[model samples]
Target chain A: MGGKVAVIDYGMGNLHSVASALEHVGAGEVLVTHDAAVIAEADRVVFPGVGAIRDCMAEIRRLRCDELLRSALVEQHKPVLAICVGMQALLQRSDENEGVDCLSLIDGEVRYFGNPLTDSEGTRLKVPHMGWNEVQQMKAHPLWAGIADRTRFYFVHSYYVAATDREMVAASVDYGVSADAALARDNLFAVQFHPEKSATAGLTLLKNFVNWNGQC
Target chain B: MALAKRIIPCLDVENGRVVKGVNFVDIRDAGDPVEIAQRYNDQGADEVTFLDITASHEGRDTTVHTVERIAEQVFIPLTVGGGIRSVDDIRTMLNAGADKVSINTAAIHNPELVRDAAQRFGSQCIVVAIDAKRVGDVDGQPRYEIFTHGGRKPTGIDAVAWARKMADLGAGEILLTSMDRDGTKNGFELGVTRAITDAVEIPVIASGGVGNLDHLVDGVLEGGADAVLAASIFHFGEYTVPEAKAYMAARGIEVRL
Candidate 1:
């Protein structure tokens, strides 16, 4: 799949790993840019970010990436993938920084994993939930093509997404709580985990994204 | 299933070459850091960490170059530690494609560096590496003190309390190493390991003295660590990463395999 791929960068986090991962998988002409014209010309767009939601939204709005992404996902019907904080930014709001408004592209809100997060056995679970965890496919989608069910993916975040529209959730994972792992609606596919840093399983997911054509 | 505990194989690099110095003495060359990282990645290692022990300024560039090659090929979480003194150092490593930068002596020198780096790069990329050793007993409890300069200098800081402070200051994870047990192959200092893991809400990577695969499991089961790190055990070809994971999985511990 040697098509132009645009990786949206708004200075919120590192783009090296994502770009390199895409290139490593032979995804053609991976461009890490904030330029709207380049993104508009690309066959696909990857919305990737890390850090706090408040700062992410600040940059997104400042650079008018919100409008760019809005056009890509809402109007153009292009295949768009959002990752980590990039996924959280698509929600209506988040509990971080005492609450911050998001893109509302998907009907959802981000909730913290709790200060003293505990399992059913009353054992305290770590925050940042940083490690590999299984992603159970909730609904069938194109991206899950070659990937097996319950494949482990790398995750690192303090908050998790809860979509108001349950049908949008494509996969779920159990931390201290059952959290939405991947959400899908039409042409947009977003994941709460970093597929780039997730190794083979992650590379397979990104490869599926490269080959997907905005179809269910 | 819940989050699987990670088994990280750490590489001690000097001048872009992997080296293992027992207790900071009698160093032996292992291989290329990039090659070693890829081998571990193939064997299903959860993540790879590079501890740059290069003391010379000229040799430091090689470490960055080594990280660049590994990040380009190995698509896993890569952490670079050792001699990371400032925010610029953190940025340099991250730009070179490291997922996290672990700061050890620097965090003790300027405690604010931890907070500053976390705020600048986000907590997910900031790791505070604590090299501590048992100092004595305090009220019938084993007391540990933070050590810097390759476990030669004492900071007079409480190990458990310092882990809490680093977490509150915005460290994403803590790489806790026991200097006493580092090269002895006796296993981790479980007492202090459990103490720090329970003290903080963030994830902790237990390091030092992983003589065998059982020590890896013990680090998680007994020490309550979110992850366990070892260098020589995997580096010396004594055991492969898949074998370690299988051992842990057979013992009823959740692993990726």
Candidate 2:
């Protein structure tokens, strides 16, 4: 059941890696495009980004990805998957670079992990939180199929989301403080980790997304 | 579970081929960079690092092609170091599908490159690699000076201070290699590893001088390193990446096992 998948590209981050992973998972003919017409015609869409929120938003607007994303999720109701900074972009605002506006697909604010991030043991943890950490599944969704309850996913980000709507929290991770790892509403699923680089568990997640029919 | 300490298998490439050498001398071929990298990925390597040891202009271009081949297949995080001199070099590698590019000689020459690269491509994709050698003590304290050209030349910059400076300059990680212990199989230089790890808020990847699995564990627990990188032990098939992870996990260290 391989179908077309579109990976949004707005001159932010490495879009090729995302496209390669999708292709590797046999997700049909994956297209990394900025054209709205191309994204509008795909069976599924993957929104992926990296770097600063302000710059990401700037390009998202410059390329009109913001409007495309809203229409894809609201009007078209296509299955949308967002990764890393792409997930943070779906929030209302962010604390990075002294505050920046976001896409606001979910009612949330992106807050920095803060300087001197420490655990319960009082040991200081590193910023960017770069490494493999377990994501505790909060609820069962189609995306969590065949993956364990606390499978590890690769994460590299300074700020995290604090969603106002608690039900959107699909998964959570504890890194000094608990942060939302994955957020889901109906057709849209967003994660703060890099599943493409997360090894076996990550590949399984992509496989699940490929076959999901946009039904919870 | 907490964030697992990473185990990265470093491949030193020359002329687009993987090689293993002691202190960059008496070098011998290992295997194809992409094939070896795929084996490590199957063995549960947290990340893979490709250090292009090639020096010639044509060889550097070959290294880029090699990186592109590996990035197309290996889905895990891939870091390419050596010969990354300009923002264009970093951009080329990132565009070639590298998750991160580690800067060494270039960062020493112009520290602004770190800031510029980080600002342009985000801090998460930029890693500053420090090749440090121990010098004489100053006021009853041991001092480490940065070295370049494969640890043959010395730069008067303090290793710890440089790590702090690079972190402040927006570097996301530090790949600290001890020149004295590199390729010695004596284990990591825990002293300087802990020193730099504590000095910077960003993650430090303790590299060079790993012989056994315990050495991998020590780099994390004793050295305070967030990750450990080794070449020979894993290259020659003395031990696999999964063996190293299982060894670290059994020692009460958090690893993705």
Candidate 3:
């Protein structure tokens, strides 16, 4: 329940709130930093982002944090969390901005949750998918520890993750179709939902992330 | 699964402190903003809105600091409104840890502000708050106009049309407050609320005129708002957030329980 948690800030996220959430969850020495060296040394790295994908990928490449993240994941094997646009950035490409390249850290593509979105039961759903939805756990992972299955989590996004490898998808929630909600591979865990802004279940998930061992 | 309905608690603060005296309840001196926010969060409030009712220029800074304090304590979605005029104001509040910023009069003056904020910070963070009052009847039918300056200056703009325009301009949500029902504690103006809700596809938070628990239920059931925001009833502790959720849940409303 305690470890140095560094939130990767690229000038376009709710960094302060994410850092505060970690602090509130009893994490030790939570730091919101863009310094590659600081993020490289932290016990856990949370790459938090909001806004558009074009600007997000632009900033990630501009600051060379992309390279830092590459090494952090492949070389150091640190437990890393990507949220919202941060999660989108980890994919190969996104349909946003008419098609933008991404970090390709995971086996997925960032796609727009089509206009006139509707759920499985033929019920109409809204774009942006703002608010809380129940996430069905697809795999038993440590990050979900202390959290009940199908607990609701707050989300605010217009794009969703479409992963090619089904084994890597840790959870998928239905909204028109079964949308991949969480992707887990090795030390990397990326979620389309904002854990910091989500209520009790969110807090518990972050607490679990802080205490995770980065094992499968 | 359908998205759960939200319960939002609105706090009107003046000069950095929460303006007390709701009715028949003790809060121990207006209760600290941070403490009150935490209590609401624990009570299962989906979101908490802070309205800076300070007229003085200096009170703006006080509200900003209060948002900073409350943000550190409360983890749920925190929306800060009142006196938000420009993109800089929105950025300042966001940096201070507000998840979203609600704009009123300024948006009316410069309608482009909503589009600008939506483009810059995404539509999910921009909440266009419309204060509406029913104008003179036209042929046995009621017409609502947008009001500003504490609901004093009438813009003569149709509320339902403005709500549609706000959504067209890329606003994520609409916070509709009825001037007639505000502070009345009678009930929400479902006629206007449903009109706006039906006109726009975006999320709408029906605010004002929440007296009893049924009023909250009516806001969602009758008005069809995505969220319900109440002030006095919650501020005075007439009913807790969970109690309201339970009430709504029993009525078959999908709320996060």
Candidate 4:
């Protein structure tokens, strides 16, 4: 199959790195573009980010790429992979920006680090949880192909998706509580970590996403 | 569950090829950084740290070129250090596709550099590298001193205290190397490693004295290091990155196996 991966460049994310990584992993025609027509023609789409959730969503809205992306995922049934803040944008709303609405691709809310219900651990655990951490795989999925049981992906984010349904969650990690690290439903998949920065394991995951058989 | 430990291969560069041994001496060319980084990336290295040991004195930063080249080929995170003294330098490296920029001597000389970089680019982009030596002292306490100019000049700063201070100053990660044990291949300084790891809330990468896979595990489990960094073993192809991860996995250390 002729595969063209369109890396959405909405002006608020690391577009080049994600494009380079997909190209390195042998994706045919890794295009970095904000144009809606270019995104519509691609076989797959990768939304990569490393900044504020609201800012990224704003850029997507400004470029009118949000409707294009939403249509691609919901109507076209094309595979969509969201990384880092890009994944957070899949949530309905984020607490980071005071009730800013996300794309609402997944049924969840993005809340900041630290549990308001329980503060027994104190404030030692800083916000924007950075560095390598383990994500426990939940259910079997094509996106996790070749990934080990407890794969450690590099995460750098302050907010997490409190997914509404357990079935929609693909993977989770402990950050004071079991939080959704990955979410998938039908043709859509989102990860809270930077796969381009997660090294080989991350590359393998991306490869799986590109080669997924749509057997979700 | 415990956080998965990272296995990193550090390359000390002079000119373009990888070099080994302490104080940047007894150097042997270990191939191009692009080639080596690709090999490590293919073999599943969690990340790669490149120390441009000669960039400062050469009055030029080769990391930008290195990052540009490797960024074109390798997909994993590439952290560039050495001779990074200002925000402009960090921006140049980041623009070249570096995931993180590590500052050692500059962060020591001016602590605000760390805070400034972290503020502008976020803490995830800032990594503070510390080189320490085991000085013979009372109570056999291993002091964490900062080594500069390729581990030539001793900064005399306590490593543990410095690590805590750097974390407070907005350093997202600490890349701590043992100057005394570097290139020795005997083993990592567990006491020195633990002191810094325990002192700081951020992740600590233990560098220096990794002879085999066992040493990597020891550095993580015994030394309390979040990650282990090695040069000679990986540079000389004594063990591939997969072998190191496999070994760590067998030791029951949570690694990306």
Report the lDDT tens digits of candidate 2 across residue range B1-257: 69999999999998878897777776989989999999999999999999987742445678878888898889899999988989989988999889999999999889999999999899999999999888989898789989988889988999999999999999999999999888889999898999999999999999989999989999999999999999999999999988898888899999998
Chain A TM-score (model 3): 0.97
Q: Which runs of model 4 end up more than 4 angstroms from their true locations?
A: A52-68, A71-77, A95-103, A112-137, A140-158, A174-176, A197-201, A211-215, B59-62, B134-142, B212-214
Instruction: Give the clashing pairs for model 2.
Output: none
Best of the two (1, 3) by TM-score: 1
Provide the lowest-lDDT 10-residue window in model 4 chain B: B135-144
Name the candidate, 2 or 3, with the larger lDDT value. Answer: 2
Clash list (residue pairs), candidate 3 = A119-A176
Interface RMSD of 2: 0.7
Better of 2 and 3 by TM-score: 2
Taking the tens digit of each residue's C-alpha lDDT, what string does model 3 give over A1-216? 477888887888468888888998898999887798888878888888898889888888998879878887889998988888888899999998899999988877988888777676665566667788889899999999888888888888888899889999999877776778899999999898889988788888899899987897
Q: Which stretches of candidate 2 lie over 4 Å from their true place?
A: B55-58
**How are the candidates ranked when ordered by TM-score, highest leading?**
2, 1, 3, 4
RMSD of each: 1.1, 1.0, 2.5, 3.8
Error of 1 at A156 (Å): 0.2
Question: What are the chain B TM-scores of all models?
Answer: 0.98, 0.97, 0.94, 0.95
Name the runs in model 1 displaced over 4 angstroms.
B55-59
A2-32, model 2: which lDDT tens digit per residue? 5999899999877878888888989999999
Report the error of model 3 at residue A66, Å.
1.1
* lDDT of model 3, residue B71: 88
